[model samples]
Target: MKPDTTAPLTFGMLVFDEVEVLDLGGPFEVFSTAGRLARTAADEPLLRVLTVAPTVRTVRARGGLTIVADHTLDEDPPFDVLVIPGGVTTAVERDEKVVDWLARRRRTSALTFSICTGAFLLAATGALDNRPATTHWEDQEELARRWPDVRLCTDVRWVDDGDIVTSAGISAGIDASLHVVARLFGEQLARRTARQMEYLWTDTRA
Candidate 1:
């Protein structure tokens, strides 16, 4: 689905215990910064980002960083995009509630994006079945083994399969997020956002 360019697109990022710090922070920084750069006197920011979790509680990230979610799954907050960040996802992948929630949300969201091993969670929901996707290089074999239906792409930093996008590892998420910004808005704005963040955008078409 094409995003409504006249208004801000709401991005709901999923957070859970043991989520990787940079996996969540990198894309958060990119989207937030891009929103700021896209804002003007007469318009709201191009995007609105918020954190969501299964419950309303403080989540401990991979490196002991704690984050409080802005919304809970019980609230069923509306969003145009869904962001899933990867870390220790063994438990999360086993969570039927969260996995089911993702499946339901994916149908209505304009985009569903995953970072690193977060692709596993998406795959659990059957979102990546028969779809081109990539993840952290270390986990590619496991992902392919676990979900044989998924078409794994090893060489690319990110794969954008229409509505679902997946990126490799932590830092690569930033590049993928910038690509999303460019896809939704324009490359000029994305370049400016990357420049503002002092990030060298490595790929625009990946």
Candidate 2:
């Protein structure tokens, strides 16, 4: 489905048990704050940010951070941008239902991206097949071993392959989110938002 570019981009970050807190929280901060900072004269935000979980409840994240999902998988609104964050993801990676949902999203969402080991879950849907992608440096070999069809790379902050983007672990998600903002809005707006977060945005690719 072709997206209406004029509409506010709705970003949904998928969260599961043991998800990396920084992976989800970092991008959430970037997109939500950037949307506020990038509002127009109409006062409509440029982006809408929310969390999606298998269920509508709090999930324990890595480092014991508890996060309540804004929407459940079946009740979420249409997502223009879907973010998959990574941590201890064996459960999500092996879930057939979740993989099917991701496959469907890949066909419809304007953009579908992943951070760190979340690439494993995305890869299970075959979305990353024969496409360049990156994950956390530590899991680079294992990801390649499991998803041989995917062109996995390392030493990169993120890989922006048009509709799909994958980034390195944790903090790298922030850079990738800013990159998305820059692509959709403008560099000036992304820079300003990064400044507000006191984060130095890096666009370097490997």
Candidate 1 residue-wise lDDT, 11-130, digit = tens: 999999999999999999999998887864458897879999887668999979989999889988999999999999999888899999999998999899999999999999998998
lDDT of 2 by residue, 139-183 (tens): 999999999999988889999999999999999998988888888
Question: Which ten-residue region of model 1 has the weakest summed lDDT?
Answer: 1-10
Clashes of each: 0, 0
lDDT of 2: 0.86
The prediction achieving the highest lDDT against the true structure is 1
